[model samples]
Target: MTVYRIPAAYLHQIEQELDSDEKETMLFLCQDLVPDLPVPDVRKLLLALNAREMLTPVSLSELLYRMKRFDLLKKVLGIGRAAVEANLATCPQMVSKYRVLMTEINEDLDKDDLTSLVFLLMNDLGMSHVKMAKDKSFLSVITDLEKLDLVSPNRLDLLESCFLNIHRKDLAKKIQKYNWEAPVHPIGSSLKYVNTLQASFPKLSLADPPGIVNKGRLKNGACNFQTEQLRMAIPETGGALGQVSNKYRMQSQPLGVCLIIDCIGNDAGMVARTFKALRFEVRCHLFLNVDSMMRELYEVARLRQHKNYDCFVCVLVSRGDHQGIFCTDHIIPGFSLERLKSFFIGDRCPDLLGKPKLFFIQNYIEASNHQETPSLVEADGGLCTIPQVADILWSQSKVDASTLDRSPNSSSYYLTTLSELLMDPHKRTLPLLDILVELNHKVYEWNRTNPAEPHSLLLEHTLRKKLFLSGT
Candidate 1:
């Protein structure tokens, strides 16, 4: 369970500043007071506002004043020194509208306690706090925070999704349409602090890795009795790292992640759906193309999820005129195989308990009679004693620099064969090894007859046992 770390005080500051009510008021003023403001200009204003502890009176005044200063007001509602110089008569109507809106809202909230007032607002909007409490629902947690004048829709999206999963579509709709009225972008908000804060968003980890520390090292007190403290920059433990136990296999239903990076062609969605239909919880990421940096991001993201899944699957569909594949941008060589696979190895990722890790790469190479040089079987570069997480690698073409036949509609041979094999009623319940063996046999026969356009299933299975499916 490795995760990104951030300061707790900084997070607390963000929570205190951007209360839901404050956000809603700002959005409304921008809509009603300064109508037709450019999206970017509005975003900039919202970001600038986030940095201040702005109360209703001051927030409304500053927003309007800035709109006038920034020259963002509509043609008819223009004002200030620039407006006067441009012959657009200073329209005091916008300022008057802002004052009236703020006065009305303040007067209304002043009539009752803020907590009770917001609870009633939720009811008026069809959210029953009582009903959510009856179900022990977490939405109650949200409304409780609302009473404290704090809420962020960015963090609430997860709770809303949970509600939707339980068939609470009514609540889901509320969250989805929750304009909170402000358009605060996380990545490039006009607020510099917010942009900086985004980089520190803490990962919701199950727990931290036990031996790892925030900073510094742990040393015996007896080493320096005079100095009661030991200060070290980074801990350098002098021992081999412990990997997740290989004997502790996951017995649950299989789950997987699918990555389809296609720069040249399409139809990966069809492949992804086929895997999803097999009941594996599938996550599909599509890129018009991928570079080395994008590829690194995928590996990091998958490593984080290693502890939660039974098996991990990745499908890399890219251009293959080169050795590895062309990521619409980079010429990723086949030599990067270990670099890609090393992310899941014992030394690198211990969270992936010795279950099965699979990779299916869909890239077509030119058909040739050229034979590749064989690897020298040195004892030093051989197998491991402890059987780690098994790896299953599948390639579209044979290793002899041969071209393969692919279906125009289906797109790739590996996917076509895999989908067909999974759908076979007789083969569905068979162990995965048997299925793959049959696939190899069938493909060999296909190439033996259709020599002109030969396509083979090149499998290098280091998996110790059957990764069999129970079948649909």
Candidate 2:
């Protein structure tokens, strides 16, 4: 028997019929089912769902019926609203009740209603949230609320109350109805909510991709060696100490040395170009074993060539766990990040003293049951102590190892978004700390749209002043 496939032309026709708002709404409704997809791409989304066998002709008709696209249901699929209603008991609803309720609420909110809602919740939300609500769409804000656990299937009082305050009792009724109506479970449904139960974060896989590098051939690893490191030489403007009194002093030409250590070879070049464009001398090394990694890091920390530079930046991409990042050999317990930081400390590397040392770690955390051991700090009887971890900012993200396996050449969501934000000309003057906050916001948006693959940013810093990478 010949297998059925969704025609590209059919999908294109359906896509052409959808407006921007409809496309966005459809994407939100399908997020839990087919995630990590580009937004507002109706055709692509339908194709993906069809490819996954999660959407049959019957289910597709039901989806359009729920979206109230009855015209398309009849014209495209030859299914009438009556047939859809009759088969409602047999068809599994792909869109969750929680998401549908939120989307309905969003549809009822006009610009003034959204403005009033944000105004009413000003004290309740954070400073960043206020900015987000003002800058982003109302649907985006709803996604943020869901991420913060402020809204969920079992919770609607906050939303209903907000609607009431805005004089939208009709909108509030939708929420009340959702709560009052008891959900019916579709018995023996073939398309299970499998993705819902999947890990929120991508788990780092142990096996390396073929042709990238050989785990045993440490000596034969590939490296994108820079013969003459490109540096941007812009004259210093402000005082020797940056223009801002509280900001970190960044007046040096060739702002810093950015070392890109990519275990997976896909996104190194993209990352290298981003930092290099930001006026930093960039160098990249790939597929190094444990020994080679240590040697390269040691050389970077103690190198005299970077003595006059303003800061030190390292971007390490590899598979890691709670303990640390893995080498090409796929070791059980990888290299400790603390030990990596130790190499850049003032005690070990004086060349970087008083200068900001930033590390952007893209680690694919392995999925396992490994537990972290607690450490006890013992006093050495010293009356006073200075923190050795000062002037260093660590920005790390852990993704599932399966991400790489699914698309070997694809970059992780975190790194791809980070590079894009860093390359923005408008953000060049912004402090690195603020840029990171923006990165978190971008990731939040990504997770909101792509529920399948969620990337989290974990930032830890010991810097005493804001570090500006550009406009020095």
TM-score of each: 0.40, 0.45
The candidate scoring highest on lDDT is 2
Off by over 4 Å in 2: 1-244, 370-388
- Which 10 successive residues of model 1 have the least lDDT summed? 191-200
Residue-pair clash count for candidate 1: 1
Please list the residue runs of candidate 1 whose C-alpha ends up more than 4 Å from where it truly belongs after superposition: 1-254, 287-303, 321-323, 330-335, 366-410
Residue-level lDDT tens digits of model 1 in 89-143: 3211222232233333333333223343344335433466544544322233444
Cα lDDT tens digits for candidate 2, 1-472 = 3445567677788889988877777887777677567664788788887776556576677677767899999889988899988877553355677777777777668898898888876765777798778966677777777676555454454566677667786886786567546232211111234311211111111222321321111112121222232222212223443344567767677888999999988779999999888888888999987556765775676578667887888999998776578879687665667567756765456668667888888887678885322111111212112223558777777666777877888887778888888888878788888888888777767767766666655776767677787745
RMSD of each: 17.8, 23.0
